[model samples]
Target: MADKSSNASKKSFKNIDDTQSYVHHLVWLDKNIENYTNQQKLNQWHELDDNIKLFSHEEECINYIQKQNDKNTESYIIFIISDSCSEQVIPKIHNCLCILAIFILTTNSENCQILNYPKIRATCLDTSDLFNRIRHCIYRDEASIGFSLLNKQDSTDAEPISLETKSNEQYPIRNLQEDQARFLWFYKCHNFMIELEDDDRQAKEEMISYFRIKYNKDKRILKPIDEFEKESLQDNAKNAIWWYSHNTIMFRSMNEALVSGHISTIYSYRYIIKLLCRQLKTLHKEYKKSISNNRLHLYRGQRLKLSLILLISNHINDLISLNSFVSTTLEEDVAKKFCLGRSKNNDEAVIFEIDIDLNSEQNIPFADIRDVSRYPEEEEILISIGSVFRIISVNFDEEKELYRIHLTLSQHEQLIVNKYIEQTFATEIDSDDQSILFGKLLFDMGEFEFAIKYFENRIRCLSDHNNHYRPTYLNNTGVCYNQIGDKDRALKYYKKASDIYKETKNQRGLGACYHNIASYYYDKGDYDTALRWALKALNERQQYQLEKASTLDLLGCIHLAQRDAEAARNNLQEALRIRVKYLSQLNTNHPDIGISYFNLGKLDSKLSSLIDAQNNYSRAEQIFRHNYPKTHPLITEVTQCLEQIKRQL
Candidate 1:
């Protein structure tokens, strides 16, 4: 039975290629570690000394060790095994570990007949511990004598080493493999290291006691642990318990930081998520392997959960990165707006509930909802306002702290809806304020259909009562409809808005309405009519330099469509100049800036200045990538244009 077990162990590890197998064993050994020295801890030691190597995973450690073995140099290694170590790799690579130990042990053996041991630290020790012990044996005993004893024993017996042998028996050696016996020595050393830590603590305590006695007698050479010294002691004490529930502590800290508005804590949470992503990716590779073997049942559910976590982590990082640009005061204002909905005059509060998705809901609880009148009539009541969520149910789940309401938006819509609730709700609002907000937020979120709905609602409310500001809402609604491809309805609304603007003698309103009309013509490929209206808009917007630049860009597009490169270049350059002047006041990643860059790039492309075109297109791409989701139309458009430029080059 002993011979058979030895033969099986040999067969199991005989085919290992190299040190990679040892990495596999180490990875497997640390699979179920509850606490780890996090990467952040390792980072603190980085650059302190060149001899220290820190690795986040096993493969890197293996490669580093292989290099060190080649140089035959003494160095330190810190390995951070992530949470994904378990249920992924198995311990089938024990042979390489033995081989590596043998290489270390036999170093300089040809000259001195003695072996030297290399220092290795990992999360855990397994069968490889025996190999380490063999190295230690060569160091402890006389080199030549040790070699002779091993050689004589090997020549005298065909039997494998037995772990249970007694000194009086013929084969007194342990009935274990040569490599397995070394584990005993490794266990002894590990226990000794633990004892050293305890001993050091006790020695420090004794020295402090002696100092206190001396201070009591001579009043010198001894001082109490001050507050600073006490803090240092407490920090050192925590090192003992650092691993216990560290992951749980990270999540709790993140939650506290988020609630307390600590930006640094939010950043730390992002880093933690990034690390988890790396761990999950490693586990996912194992899951794929299990699938090919028809053993996916073992990990399919776990894989699904990990994938969900990875997805959420990516989204959260994106949100936090975007929010870093917003001011703290602005964030507070937005929070207040969403937390204080308006109350109705009938003594009933307007309960605003946001349906996040099919599986989840959230109620917006307002602490002090005040009744506000929109129209002059006291009977008219406005319940709620936002571009994102429509009321499905007002029911609140007091017990669960979540509202069980169905969201009417799709997945993408829900994301933008939540974003609007977070970013744009930074000011007090009433029913009349809804029209402007709904148009702006929905337009910004790329929800043109919903934007038009709110704009039309606002227009209807004003037109029904003969409000003089009806034309402005009409023009805004026309822009939204035009964005959604309802060209005929867009034209009708534009004409009505144009007529009303003329009646009111609102030059700015007329210019903006004319630009929309010109935009419609441009989309229809009627460059002549588009150019005519664009020029009219430009002329009226000349006094408003900011608005004038936009009209100039539109004119440039119209000219470019007509194949007039020179005119397009002139108009686009002027627009770019105007945009640059206001760059400091505007969001650096404003969509309009990207559009201007894109238009300039297009004109340069038409002129066959591929280098200039590429540069401009690159600028546009950067802005679009930074400001919008990857799938946004503007980003997609810029990507397509950049690809075309690459082809042209």
Candidate 2:
């Protein structure tokens, strides 16, 4: 076998668990993807090796390589960046796509203005620079830790993220000229580490086996899609509703709400890749069974195992590659190679579970293993979406080198919505729409602080186009603030939204602004002010049948709180009608259905409809418990209320 030690010790390959080589991050690039695409004009990658080095500051390194090396056999790539590019001007991945853009030149230069791409500071990073840096331990090779996207990319207008917990004690910066001889380096290595649990493997095998059987056993041949059974119909929002006085079945439809981002939202289910990974081992057992029965060739099991490995690896590779730039790791490929620095006989790093404390000293031993037996007990074991880092412990090598130590964020927070006022008035689409979407996800995930930053990023991007987007951004900002209990900021934004709306003939915008402002006032116990705004918004929304759900719901709550029993009943009934009709098309088990039911139950209880309230409450409780964690506070509260109500009965 090849001396694994020597090859591994040289280390720093592109596809390692701890380190990634090709991780490209274009911060705030999501905001202006079009600008980058246009500026980079990705059609000239092959012809511009020299130009590529200019942005990465690797011109000197490339020159050094060409001069010193005899034949230049190293088939490595160097990236070139543009000096004028900002986050809005740079593409997110400085990779093959960026390179291919130049060669592909899909659009004519005359039509260039038609495409808007986010851009990055185009520079070059050469293999020579990377190699020498690995030898010397110089961090000049490290990408400058830029401020948050809120700071205008063209100028340094940013609040640098603060590190609440410091990373590990700082080592003295290293000199690049001096070889690895000067630094005490620890080499790393990696191997494919299995993670599939027995039960998980079984489930996967069952799923696949079921599919295979369905595919092969007495197969009804594939039929054309156009030939179908008689179409079925249901009493759904998609269907027409007939209205009558006594036996009226109302079907109110919701406009299909785009989950904001063009990207599909990952929900509680549909984690296909993860699901398959979990069940691979079960198929392994089946593989053995087939082999023993003399019905399977040796290669068959190997093929399946290989497929499983490749599948798992590809998923991980994707995660690493996509997140590499943002995580400040070399792209995933480079990070993967970081593991090769160790021996095959050495401890193989199965995983890397790290909480990067963006600020304070954190001991991120560059290498780790999946020593599940020796794992630390932490509050939450966080394995991110990209790169399932298996910490490979116990690979100590004196000759190993640290190519670069990156300065990156250790923590994340979600920012609550604010500044709906800004959103309403803003005319141009935000350059950082992706970040805004990410922020929304964080909000949905309850990472309020992080969400706030994303929305703020969108808000800042709208500064230039404030006249058009100001209302919506401001409104969103206000909503975020309200969620986080920042009443002052929320009110400020809501008022701004109101002012912006007054400039428009849009009653919908006006109503939304008034309603949220009323909510803020109500939350603060400013009953009179709350009532005035709510009534105003309600009266306006009463004109538009399309968006009456929110208005009615808010009105119902307002009336219920004020003990206006008759008004509350009417509003709640209307809101419930809207909600039920809208939800009818969804699966009965959907969590939102439970929320609507719970709200209806609350209204019923307030009106002393004990049996009706009890039934709705029971439905709500089942859905909530099934969809949410047992420890969820909402679940606990609902359970407690239900018990109390039952005791009253």
> All models: lDDT?
0.41, 0.36
Model 2 lDDT-worst window of ten: 184-193
What are the runs in model 2 whose C-alpha is more than 4 Å off?
Answer: 1-439, 526-529, 542-546, 586-592, 607-615, 621-649
As for model 1, its CA RMSD to the true structure in angstroms is 31.9
Q: For model 2, state the Cα shift of residue 223 in Å.
A: 60
Tens digit of per-residue lDDT, candidate 1, span 315-389 = 211211111111111122221211121111111111222222323322211111112211111111111101122
Clashes of each: 10, 152
Per residue, candidate 2 scores C-alpha lDDT tens digits across 289-322 of: 3433322110000001111122222222111111
Q: What is the lDDT of residue 440 in candidate 2?
A: 39
